[model samples]
Target: MKRNILAFMAVMLMLCMSAQTSQAQLKRFSIGPYVEAGFPTGDFSTTHNPGFGVGLGADVKLIAGLTAVGSVGFDYFKGKTIDNGNTKIASAKVIPVRLGLRYQLISILYVKVEGGTANFTGDYNNGTGALVAPGLGIRLLGLDVEGKYEAWFKDGTHGFFGLKAGYNF
Candidate 1:
């Protein structure tokens, strides 16, 4: 029920942002710092729970309704206590470099998809894997709000529901 409500709210927000675009000239370029919280699912939950991410990103307008997006992000997931033993206080760290495009459906509302490799290490076996993300974005008053579902297909299938908010300049 919570996911459904969040989805509904996102749709309504896009509608509202689209309505406002008709009244003002929208910005074509933006750069900023972003932070994301991740909820683990599937096999990822076996070892790690919820986590946090930080990144820097940029958007450049290409053509009508199209923009190029790129980001470098870092995420940390703490290990879970298993068999009554604490795995190391050190958290697994993952760095991902992604590039993709955003399509503006209406005014300040857009749909985005990105894919790249995430490199992970620390307190666990080092590994690299592909990351795919599909998401929605709402830009209002120099602030950017995004919600995305991320998947890491690696040693095990890992998934996350992510929420990200940032200030864009």
Candidate 2:
């Protein structure tokens, strides 16, 4: 199982690295940084407050209108007050690494899906989980605006709806 996962990662990495051909009229690659605001949903909201994150991403044009994308990011969430407002859950932090594909649907519109892993650290515990995100975005000039639903699964599932903005170079 581990070997298979490694093999898949290797293939994705190769695809992301192979944009060396010079004949394409479009840009072959882009790199950017983004900031996000996240709102926890379902039971996750009961214990956690809204969060913010920052990420850096890279994209390699695989073909016309298609790109392979990868990113690493950090998110921080403070705990919510509980038990008659006398106690609070510990703040949590997450580091996420992801790889995925983006397909342009129109001149400035795109859709994307990403899967990877998120490592979680809290005041009292730590763990890792599988992460999946599906999103819609628009690119105007060098700026991008996106909205995504992100789910993280370990023993159970937690999710957030997020809005992000970025500038690609």
Candidate 3:
């Protein structure tokens, strides 16, 4: 937890410096809501199954084609069975704080790389942690679609892939 906070603060400091450097070229801010679905890609011996998440987020254009995004989300998962006839059934709700940089390829298409923490709670795990993720996004007809891969590095490292859809304003 302490380490995560320190890392977040460090990233924020860097963002602040970047913001200052690009203040003159900053664009406007935009807010939107999003829904995401995540799939587990490894063994789930003692954890919940694949999950779905939904939340709200916003983006602020800091440079010519760069944007900073932050979001708060809740994820729910159903537990699964493991070896040795042991069934682990549980549910979890997580809060994911994300910051990303978006590079616009055109008027409606962009690519993004994001990283942040996922604070989890509920019937499974009782701890908070951070994960680094990178993703790509595209906009079409007022809707945005994205796919991201997240790697969590704490006690043990694990990875997951997520697909999200939303509307951008």
Candidate 4:
């Protein structure tokens, strides 16, 4: 897990350096906090309710309409069942770290693709998974409203659809 995180950071650093050298100047940079909700999908939907989370995100403009983006967040979901017949399963928690690139389609609309790792903790669930999410958003008056689908691959595939709202600072 540590090695994976370190590798991710190294790649991000390299990208940043290369962008700085290649671009004449960055268009913009922003950082902000966001609140998000996740609706479990596939088999995961049967066992868990909706999840809520909070995160901090940053964007570095590499060119006119392209940006490098990254975020770290924590999410929690309540279980629908009392037990899985063996152990008591009450809730689940996830910590996700992600990096991606975003392209602005127009002035207010953008699309993004991100991949990273997520740490899961819950009853009978403890491990790390590779995660991928593709999303679209609209930026209005410094506020962002976005939606995406996220899939985590570990022992099996767990997926969710997420909505996020935030302000850029």
Candidate 5:
């Protein structure tokens, strides 16, 4: 009886091991392309118009429902010259390298917080400043959509509202 039980248990274990799917392999890393829109607020709105950007990023799973993310992106903004509200638009470019943490709250919902440095180069330059944002992420139709409030610690500017959407692999 003991030999028969042992044989049955061994067979079951082997069957379970073979039944493992490709999901585990795919879940290890996810890379995608993203698009973002920015809505400036407070002094920011007064000094800069709305903006849009596009980039690509990747996320690596750290633990259960946790991921480490790194991304580089570019943004374009129309800076409304400090002297006066000018109709002539001076284009400002921002290139940001960001690293952050994302925690899954549920099957389709997640919360993410990130901080990094953005290089402000081009016509209207304000040097470089630290960037911080807290966001909510949702997975739908094979895409991840996020809404965030971005805070910029700089000389003269406030934060902005950001909308992001991306497809994951």
Candidate 6:
């Protein structure tokens, strides 16, 4: 997990340097900090368990209607038991570093392909691995809404749908 985080940071630094060179010609480059509350929905042992998460990201408009996004986020899942009562399965802290290509479908709507590595911590028996998530987004009234299905090759697959309300600045 530590190594993955380091790698992600390194990549982010490189991207930032590149962006700096092109900043003069870019239309807009903005950063937004967001918080998200959602649950993990999957067929794994733990389902319908609620969790809260937060993230910070930057969006760099590379073209007129296209942008390059990089984000790092974390989530904590209070696991569930097989029976009715709740059990302490495990709490996961996920750091997802994604590089996405965004296309403005309309004036206030956009879709993105989110592919990144999810460095996880906690007692998730399936093991920690990377994930490739494809998602969509919409920008309206200074708020951005996004939903994506994440697939972990080893740490179990889950769908994460999030609604983020943040100012793009």
Query: Top model by lDDT, which number?
Result: 2
> Which residue runs of candidate 6 sit more than 4 Å off their true CA positions?
3-7, 10-27, 45-48, 84-87, 140-142
- TM-score for candidate 6: 0.77
- Top-TM-score structure, candidate number: 2
Candidate order (lDDT): 2, 4, 1, 5, 3, 6
Q: Per-residue CA lDDT of candidate 6, range 1-169, in tens?
A: 6676677667766666776677746536666777776655566325546666787777777777888877778866666665656455555556666778888989988887767777666566434666776767788755787766565555457555555555565
TM values, all candidates: 0.77, 0.84, 0.75, 0.81, 0.77, 0.77
Model 3 C-alpha lDDT per residue in residues 58-149, reported as the tens digit of each score: 66676787777766566666677656657655665666777777888888778888778777677556677777878887877558898988
Candidate 2: regions farther than 4 A off = 1-26
lDDT winner, 1 or 5:
1
lDDT of 5 by residue, 1-169 (tens): 2343345345534433443343455556666789999998897787688999898766767789998776677888787756564465466687766779999999989999988777677766557878888999897646999999977666755578999998976
- RMSD each, Å: 10.9, 3.8, 5.2, 3.7, 14.1, 3.0
lDDT over C-alpha atoms for residue 81 of model 5: 59
**Would you list the C-alpha lDDT of every candidate in the order shown?**
0.76, 0.82, 0.69, 0.82, 0.75, 0.67
Candidate 1 backbone collisions, by pair:
none
TM-score of 4: 0.81
Model 2, 51-71: lDDT tens digits are 999987778777889988887
In terms of lDDT, the poorest run of 10 residues in model 2 is 15-24
Task: For residues 1-169, write the lDDT of model 4, one tens digit per residue.
Answer: 6675566567656755665577537435566789999999987787788999898777788778888888877888887764555544567788788989999999999999999988887753688888999999998866999999988888787789999999866
Q: What is candidate 2's CA lDDT for residue 146?
A: 91
